[model samples]
Target: MTSALSLDGVFLVPPEHHVPDTDRAAATQLLGCDDRTLDTLVRRGLTVRDDRFDGRDLFNLALHSGTGRTVPEQAFAFSLRWMRGTAESLLAPRTLSFTLTAACRCADVVLALPRPDRYGGAVIPAPEADVVAGTTVSATIRTEGRAVPLRSPVLRGLVEEFAALGVRWVKLPDALREDESLVTTHRVATCESASRWLARRCREAGYAARTRIGWVVGMLDLVHAWVEVTDDDGETKVVDLIFAGFAAGVPGANPLLTDPAVALRTNRLVPTGFEVGARVARHDCDAPVTVRIKPVKE
Candidate 1:
């Protein structure tokens, strides 16, 4: 007969209810388990007092287990759940929506938000540097960006995968690509920048990517800043990031000057006029010629 509940790796729904029977059978097949496993789970107290574990949780856990490390996507999802609220409230619906948001956007980000805030470098507005000549132009654009250093592990893995694939990018797409941020269509936030090139690399590897664009502080009076992506179109685009300024302060001293060697490492926009006041590479620098103005690739 059907088991009362499933847990300890084998729980679906109550046997008496035929309505959930079809679902039970499917779960049993996917979980690769039988009634005996359910009994054992009940004895071990992993069972539900009222009934079986929620079907969705079972599916997510199984999918998570199966992923192993082929992707850190599962782990990232789980962490988002914990970051929302108390452990019990984790199951609450509104919180779940927050957890399942398609992607992070400049607007969706909340400043001084609680745990699970992975938006790039989190600069808490240094009181001293706060007043760097405010202007009418929107600094709001920069505020939404999560500061990410080029050294995070997840980004490193993606870059390596891209290099291995040997991507050959052609031209930018005629239409604006979809965004992972909201439910509706969106153009690439940083589309005009290097995102087009980065997306090509990831696509070649059978992975997905997006580019977040903006102008670098003190760099160009106006230029796009973008970070590469590999998350499945709608998950968090920027993970494991650092404040652009702190990244520059490390022992290497002036990180912006040294170009990244890898095909996929993320980096901050170079400061304004560092190389442009005059030619500044000291002979081992990897950056190509720094043009006075960014060139239009035709």
Candidate 2:
């Protein structure tokens, strides 16, 4: 049996670290605030004392339309940033500094489950949300490992093969907690499930890879995730395995951005990773707004 390769360094930033700069104008609209209120706040300024505008606020006020109560921090952070920019821009056009720090470090939960050969086996385990106390032996979740670099040739190859699966998404009820559950319970592939399956396939194939939990642009509520591969050419690229089949007409696009609207919106990519204490800086003073990832804190 091949030894299971651990995917280290593939850390995910905690939800608190995902504070996104938001559009103040759009956020006002989504929060159902009136124009006069926005004008008042802009003229007077965002009060630091108000709990609604506190630093810990992670609500995605830009979600002009969504059913959930807890908004994405990225949306809320971006909104606050926009407000600051607008207020300062009126006085003078100066470079604004934006910094993102992970709220708390995160430890990965690695699970060892029954590996199904390509022919037949459970691709992933069900009850992914269930917590095990002491007696559980079917699977083992480990928490220690280094982050895997996505620029390995082996990983790139896995991306190609997984995309070749040509898995079609099976739309299940929103009632389902995780899209990956669909794969274990129903054998269908959604963006979430497909990415999970791809990560698994990469592991089974003996390449170091891991799954990430985040969203594609413009579809934050739907909550999209994908795989990051280290290529032989020293490039780390995000592979949307399922979306590759759906959008690229094949699965090997360099960035593999899935949403058409987001693809049309920008030429720059928002920096992605799961590093705690890593800094995400957005430079909008230039021609195109670009995000830069800084070294993770020790």
Candidate 3:
């Protein structure tokens, strides 16, 4: 079933709309490096257009410049500032579209395609999926959507309430060490683990919450997991603990949980069923699947 929401009139800010910029002097100051070092970064592939440097380029250089060394706090702050700024810009109401395709060699296949839904101040209108079934199966799915400022009071209240749970965000390698049997069994959790934990907690609290597996679209799309919580009024909201923790630099702050201005820029959320791409099988026979995603020009 497709969602009833529509994104026809929303205005979306593309990634190019808010590329952070800085002069040479400001760039040096932000990186805490000398001109020569900055030049070295340029030689290493950092683009400097019209004497202005891109914040993302500078952040990457600073993050990986020194071998076996921790990134300086100043440089980290510079990255966070740019990230926050870009995220804020992406929160503006906007429309977007993408073409998604999946192919597999199998007699029977079920492709879990991108479905229309509302979250992060965005609404994805339902689109038709073209499916061809045979010895080889192929499906083409198109999605067009719009995002507006998230200002729901119930969502905001849920954010504040979840914050009271005090769950610490931990990335992998470290997160693997924590207990996953229960949310309270460990203080730190990764996105998937945390989402599952939060879903259970929300259900216990009399709220309808479910863990969702999908992709977080950005400069690079990555498999991600999050939660969807529905209020008594039947309104649903997204709860992404990992993104919230990273954006706010504090688990308690959780701006991504509700603050539209702090939304991820150059990045959007795409939820799917069970897994991304396609799942093809016939009488215990499984087929390998290939999936591709590209922006559709309107």
lDDT of each: 0.31, 0.35, 0.47
Q: How far in Å is the alpha carbon of 298 misplaced in model 1?
A: 44
Tell me which of candidates 1 and 3 scores higher on lDDT.
3
Off by over 4 Å in 1: 1-194, 232-235, 239-251, 254-298
By summed lDDT, the worst window of 10 consecutive residues in model 1 runs over: 93-102
Candidate 3 regions with alpha-carbon error over 4 angstroms: 1-110, 117-179, 250-267, 273-294
Which of 2 and 3 is the better model by lDDT? 3
Write candidate 1's Cα lDDT for 40-102 as tens digits: 654665324345444433443343243332122243344223222332231221210001011
Q: What total of clashing residue pairs does each candidate reach?
A: 16, 24, 4
Report the number of the highest-TM-score candidate.
Answer: 3
Segments in model 2 whose C-alpha atoms lie over 4 Å from true places: 1-157, 173-187, 233-235, 248-298
Residue 208, model 2: lDDT of 54
lDDT of 1 at 81: 30
Q: Which structure is stronger by TM-score: 1 or 2?
A: 2
- lDDT tens digits by residue: candidate 3, 172-196: 3322422345345544455677777
Ten-residue region with minimum lDDT total, candidate 2: 1-10
